[model samples]
Target: MSNQKIYQYLMAFGHFCSDINQTALTALLPFLIAIHHYDYTTAAMLVLVANMVSSVVQPLFGHLADKFNWVWIVPVGLLLAGGGIAATGYTSDFWQLCLAVMISGIGIAMFHPQAAKLVNLASGLHNRGTALSIFAFGGSTGAAMGPILITASIALFGVQGTLTFLLIELLACLMIGRYYRALTELNGGSIKAKQANAQATQQDQWGAFSVLCVVMFGRSIIYYGLNTFLALYWINVLGTTETVGNTMLSIYYTIGAICTLFGGKLADKFGARNVLKCGFAVLFPSIALLAMTGNELFASALLLPMGAAIHIVYSPTVVLGQQYLPNRIGFASGITLGLAISIGGITAPILGKIADIYGLTTALYSVALVPLVGAFLLAKPKD
Candidate 1:
């Protein structure tokens, strides 16, 4: 059997590949609009297709992972995700584009809960928060790379440039597939690991988890808001070119990626609940202040605090959800990592409609207030 560290890193690698594809779609939206002449609502619907489908189905995948040996999800999901983006460059039809993105979303849905369950079992209780954070870092890194890869590809080869990235995901899939047993070993190889899984009490706390889901849904709104609208805000509100807009986005993603690492470590040291509270405390004000900025440089710089505040809870909330439902790790992960995020993704269209009707500044400020709605929910203990 391979060491737990190998399995941990391997899972993180798969996460990287999975999210790189997921965010690549987001990164490509400007190109899609510029080239195809799509409206904000149409473009936003593409995201809704990619993320909502995954959001709705992820719990099923999680339940399957909990009930059976479904480790195949890791590699297969990577291929589906990257494959969808690769396919994106080949089509121009709106409906066809939606199909491709939805497929990619399905791939994302297949990966997270199962992978998270493995990470939980691998780390044991004492370090589980940090372990999950490390796992989350992989996805954040992929999110960081997605915009750069897709944009560079387009800059060089037009829309078809996204196809070049397929090789990266393909290589990762084969590697993960080849070592499938390593993933299985994560839950059972060591006596301690077995003990850790056993120690997880079966008492499920649905009420607390439901409240946590609402809080997470609010976080997702801010996250999806930035991912979906930040570029457009650069263009429409700040008068930056698409190139500069994407560059700012790339910076936002990269900073968020680095912060995920520290977010995990902080959760381990300060406790997930404390980290979560502090994160939201910072998020509410930072996001509100971001809406009031007008200078392009200052608006872009504002994303740093926004990214830190949003990402700080990425791992902690997942860990806290698990604590709330010790016996339902897969379900908890599904809600924390998948469904709540999807809820936010699904809301993009509504915001897009608002942007269409009311103007971009109003839409931006509206989303900034979403974090404040959930600040009270975290007042209770996370664990």
Candidate 2:
């Protein structure tokens, strides 16, 4: 393969490693609830804490990435991400668990902006959507695998099985370290060169970006809602085994991973805004049906369309965000990849509360409404 392809794959591998830890936390939630006797809101708060920290720090990290070449953050962040989740197994208090999760969140925050900045530089303009989709695919696949890995680990070693993430991350760090020089070389030169080039280009379109943010925010809520509760929905509402519920979750993410790549190619062909509109259009009905359905076979069948609708917009949004703010690619990436996405986690507790007071079915129905709003926003004249 060419150096560019190799570098993209390497970065994608890093993305996979980083995201596994993020999803690992989600996968661990049921176990946490069962083992610790925690309520729904308390368990969801773990996601909140992680996303809150990531949402707060990712922009700062992205700003730093814009100013300097922070290539070293990748491996360091991977280590911390893996290590933090591993520490979760050992925590004795709620505060301690939150602290460990916070560390993982920070590590995740550190990885995205810099890594995405490098991916953008490597892909250039023509194949950006495809390249980013590949990168996103890796994370999505890792997300798919996370539940299986964690659940299998727990089956074998109990909660302490989270330590497996530490070993996996260490291996990823060493691999990335080995390729450290190649990664910098892919940057084409110093951050100053990139900044100078950006300055000479089209200006940032704040209005368009604001609209994109709304689109992304809606997508985030739906994505996190399904991700956080799908397994529980299977277990609690559908009367499936935990193993079966998590397996369905794995299938959901695996389908999303495949669609993520397909979505990028579609974006390249049809235009990002069109792809964004198409995704939300499909998403609204899919989620609405998913909420309304009670049959296990039917719910499982819906995952295919639901996964496609949610992930089809993934790379397109990221690419458009970068295109909209050409001069602030890293910062844009931080917002698109980190902050806008994680902001949904801020609502996790609220969803948890809804689930607590009403039901998971009602909470999911609420999630279905978000995409309708996104579709309305998308129907507006181009910004």
Candidate 3:
């Protein structure tokens, strides 16, 4: 394989490492509630805090990446992301837990824009969708692994098991550092290419971009809603063991990972917009069915199509966002992959409250409505 391929894969691996911590905290939610006797809303507050910080800061980091080479932030962010989550197990105070989660959020904020910018640069123009799909695949796989890893760690070491992510991220940072030169070279190429294309006139489509952001926001709601509550829904509503619940979560993300890879290829063949529309169309019914079903075996079976519907749009959205704002790819990435995505986390507390008052099923049914709005937006004339 070429050096570029190796570097691309390395970036994807780094993404895997960074995202492992993202889902790890969610996976630990049950443990947190049981061990500390926290209520649903309070436990969901941690997700709110983390995503709030991440959503706010990620754009600034992306703007900074656009203005200058900030490749070093990648490894540093990885370290902090891992360290913050790792500290969660040791904290007993709610405020302290919030602070720890905030730290991880900042770390995540620091990592995504620069890393995505580098990946875009490395992939060049031809196969950007495929490259980004690989990147998304890494994140999806890490998300899938989060529940299993945390479950196993907790089984062996109790709540303190969160430290496993620290060790894993440290190794990832070292590996990234070893390839630091290659990454810088890719960034350098991006700079040179920008200079060369200084005379080229590619207009930014803000109107369409705005519409896309709205669609993505709706998608984010569905994604984060499921990520935060699916396991709880399984355990509480379906009368399953914690292990079974987490296994269901793992299955959801594992299928999502596989679909993300193929989604990119399909986008490359068809069109990103077409694939995106199909995804939203599929997502609505899948989520609606999931919300209505009480049968454990059938609900488990639904994860296959549900995971596909959610993730099939992942790479296409990122690629389209960058295409829309060609000059500010990093900033576009921050909005699409970070802000748009993390904003969904903002609703977790609200959903938790709904789940607290009404029920998990009601919260899930509420989540199911979001994609229909996304589908409506997609049906509008192309921006």
What lDDT would each prediction earn against the true structure? 0.82, 0.86, 0.86
Model 3 CA RMSD to the hidden true structure, in angstroms: 2.0
In Å, residue 312's CA in model 2 sits off its true spot by 1.3
Instruction: For candidate 3, write residues 161-213 as lDDT tens digits.
Output: 88988898889888888878878877867444773274135777787788888
Clash count, one per candidate: 0, 0, 0
Q: Per TM-score, what order, best first?
A: 3, 2, 1
Query: Can you tell me which runs of candidate 2 are displaced by over 4 Å?
Result: 188-199, 375-383
TM-score of 3: 0.96
- Please list the residue runs of candidate 1 whose C-alpha ends up more than 4 Å from where it truly belongs after superposition: 187-193, 200-202, 378-383
- The stretch of ten residues in a row with the least summed lDDT in candidate 2 is 374-383
Model 2 residue 31 CA deviation in Å: 0.7
Candidate no. 2 TM-score: 0.95
